[model samples]
Target: MSKALLVHPDDSVATLVEPVAAGESVTFAAQVVTALTDVPSGHKVAIRVISAGDPVVKFGFPIGTARTDIAVGAHVHTHNLATALDGTLDYRFTPSVPFVREAVAETATFQGYVRSDGRVGTRNEIWVLPTVGCVARTATRIAALADAAHGGAVDGVHAFTHPFGCSQLGDDLAGTRSILAALACHPNAGGVVIVGLGCESNQIAALLAEIPEARRSAIRTLSTQLAGDEIDEGVALVAELVALAKAERTTVGVDKLVLGVKCGGSDGLSGLTANPLVGRMSEAVVDAGGSVLLTEIPEMFGAERLLMDRAADEVVFDRTVKMVNDFKRYFLDHGEPVSENPSPGNLAGGITTLEEKSLGAVQKAGRAIVSDVIPYGGQVSRAGLTLLEAPGNDAVSCTALAAAGATAILFTTGRGTPLGFPVPTIKIASNSGLAARKPGWIDLDAGAVLEDGFDAVADDLLARLCDIASGAPTAAERNGEREIAIWKRGVTL
Candidate 1:
C-alpha cells in the first residue's frame, strides 16, 4: 500500500490510508520523509510546517485553519485544525472548461413496470399507508396479512408508518398530507390501503383529496374504530389491494423512470470518485428524458448558489432559495448553527466544515438544470434535476425521495453503510478498501475511478443500475435491510 495519498499537488496535507507510526520514514510520490507524529487511518498529516492560523489545505481547498503552531509531518485533525467562517474557499459551478461527454452506450434498458400515469417503476408493491400514529398497528397488521397471502405473486407488501399524521397544524399538516398522497400515487405502488382512526386530525378525506382523481380510486381506506376494531377487516382490505397490485406488469423505457441520488458516510474520495460517477449516470438518465431527484437540504448548504444559477426559471430559483433559508431557520430555532454539520465520521474522513461537505455533496446532482424545489414531504412533479427539502439523514432522505415517486435510488458511501429503501438502492463504494472489506453491502466499486479511469468505472455503474432496475437484487435488498423514515415537521400530542 502507498504510504500517503496527495489529493492535489497544491495540498499541504497527505492522507494516510493506514496507520503510520511516528519516526518512521516513508516515501510519498518522489520524496521520502520521516513521520513526526503518528497518523491514524483516514486522517491527514502535514507535509510541511504550518504556523498558527495558517490554512490547512486538502483536495486543493481550505478545509480549516491550524489552531496552533504545527511542525512538518505533524498530524492535522480537530485538535489542531479549527473550522472558521472566514477561509479561502472556492467553488466551481460552471467549470472554466466544459466537461466532455464520454460517448459509450450499450443499448442498455431495464424491464420496469409502467404506471398509468406514464411513470416507470422498478418494483410493483402494494403500500400500506398509515395517516396517523393511532392506526400504525393496523397498517402493520395489514402489511403482514398481505405479505403472507400474496407472498408468491407480488413483490412485497410494505408498511409506511409514521409517528405524526395527526396533531399537526398549518405547514406541518399540509406537508404530511402531501407526502402520504405522493406515496399513494407513486409508480412503484400499484395499490395503496390507507389506515386511519375516524376522528384523527389528518382525515382520510383530506389525504384522498390531494391525490389525482384517477389514483384515488385505487386506494382503499379503513378505520379501525368503524370496523369494530376487528384487525381481520384491515387484513382483508389489504389482501385485496395486493391482488390488485399483482396485476401490473413490467415494461421497458427511460421515460418511465424516476431516480433519486443520495450520499452517506462520505469521505475525501466521495467527490473525487463515486459521487461524480453517479453524476454521470444521472446525466444519462436526464438525457433520456427521465427525472433525477436530489435531496438532503443541509448537504446543499453552501452549494445552493450553484443550483440557483442552474435553475430552469425564476420561480424554480426562488423556491430553491426559500427551501435553503427555511432549513437554516429550522436548525437555528433549535439553538443549533446551520453550519454545525459534518458529523464525527465526516471529520475522521477529512471533511472539516459544512461548506467542504456541501461542495462534495452537490456533485451528485450533475450539471442538469434545476427544474423545481419541493418542500419537505412534498411530491416531485417536474422532471430533470429537482431538489427535495429533506434532512441529511440517510433513512429520512431515502424515504422522502421514494414518496416523491423515485422508483430507484443511487446511494454513494465512503465509510460504508448497509441500509436500503423500499425501492431498490444501488450502493456505490467511494473507495476500494471499503468495497473489498464490506463485500456484502457495496454493490459497485467506484474507487477504480481514482486509480484506473473514470469512464470505465462509470460504465460499470450504469450496467449495475440497469441490472438492479431489471430485477437483479442489490446487496441491500438481498440482506432485507429495507429501512424508511419520514421527516416530521410538527408537534405530536
Candidate 2:
C-alpha cells in the first residue's frame, strides 16, 4: 500500500496512511520526500510548496489558508493552517448531473412490523416516555418494572428520558412537545406510554393533541399528579398496550425503508473509507425507492454546495439555501463562528478545519439528490434524500434522526461511541483498529475498505443492515443503551 494517499490529483497535501517519523521518506503523489518532522497517522503532510495566505488543498478543495510557509513533507495542521470559511455568502443553484432513479430488485424485503398507518417498523418494543423531567425517574422505573414483568412477551421495554419538559418557552417547549409526539408515534414502538407531570409546561393532554388521532390507539397516557401510584399505573397501562402491540412480523418491501445516515467520532479515514461506504449503501437503498435522511447541518459549513447542486428541483434548492444560511445565522446569533465547528478530538484525529470535516461528513449521503428539508422536530416529508436541521453532536443528531422516522440508522465513526437512539443504530468503524478495540460498539468495519474495497465492504454492510432491520439486535440494543435527546433551542421561562 502507498505510504500516503493523494485524495485527488490537485491536492496540495496528502494524508499519511500511517504515521511518519522525522527524516523518514514517504511516497506522496509519486514523489519521494523525507519528512521534516513526525506526522501522526491520518494527518496531512504537505506535498507541494505553499506560501502564507495561499490555500491548502485536500479532496480537491481548499480546506484552509496556509498560516505560514509550508515546505514539502512538513506537517500541515492547526499551527500552520487556518479556516477559509467566512460568514454566509450568496448562493445560486447549479444543477449537477440529472438524477436517474436506478432499478432495484423487486423482491427486496426485510422482516418488520407493518404499522396500520403504512409505516414499517424494525422493532416491536414498548417505549415509556416522560413529558417532563420531574417524572423522568418515574417513567424509567415504570419501564424497568414493566419490562421485567412483561419482557418475555415483546422485543424489549425501554424508557427515553430527558431533563427539559418544564421551564422551556417558545420553540423550546414546542420542540419538546413535537419530539415527544413524534416518539409516541414512532413505528418501532409497538406500544407507547407517555408519562407526564400534570403541572409541567408540557402537559400530557396538550402533547397528546400534537399526535394524529388515528395514531393514538397505540399510545397510553399517565398524569403522575392525578394517578394513584403512577409507577403501578404506568406498568399496568403498558400491560394493556401489550395487546395493542402484537409481535407479529411480516416481510416488508425495501421501498418502505427510511434510513438515517450519520457519522460521529470521525477520523481522517472517515471521509476516505467509512462515509463513502455508507454513501454506497445509501445509493443502493435510494435506488430501491427507499428514503435516506442526513443531518448535522452545521458540519455542512464549507461543503454545502455539494448537496445544493444535487437538489431535486428549484424548490428543494431554495430550501437547501435557507437551511444552510439559517444555521450560519444561528451560530452568529449566539456569538459563535460558523467555520469553527470541528472539535479538539477532530483535530487529534487529523481534521484541521470545519471545511475539511464538512467535506468528509457530507459523503454519507452518497450521490443522492436532495429531495426535502425537514425542520428540527419534523418527519421526512418525502422520499429520496432529505436533509434535516440539527447540530453535529452525536446524541442530538442521532435522536433527531430517530424522531424523523428512521427505522435503522447507519452511523459511521473512527472514534467509537456506545450510545444508541430509539432505532437500531448500526455503528461502522472507519478503521479496523477501532473496530477491533471496540468490537461490542461497532457492528460493521469499514476499515476493511482499505483491503477489501468499498463495494465488497459495503455489500457486507448492507446485508448486515438487512439482518439488523429484520430483527437482529445491534450492539447498542443488546447492551440496553436506548436513549433520546430533545433539541433545546429556546430560552427558559
lDDT of each: 0.79, 0.89
- Residue by residue across 130-156, what tens digits does model 1's lDDT show? 899888877888788778887567787
lDDT of 2: 0.89
Alpha carbon deviation, residue 490, candidate 1 (Å): 2.8
Model 2 segments more than 4 A misplaced:
28-31, 99-107
Which TM-score value belongs to model 1? 0.89
lDDT of 2 by residue, 9-126 (tens): 9999988878899999988657877789999888989998999999999888899999999999899999999998988889987999965655542457789988887889999999
Among the numbered candidates, top TM-score falls to 2
RMSD of 2: 1.5
Candidate 2, residue 433: CA error in Å?
A: 1.2
Cα RMSD (Å) between model 1 and the true structure?
A: 3.3
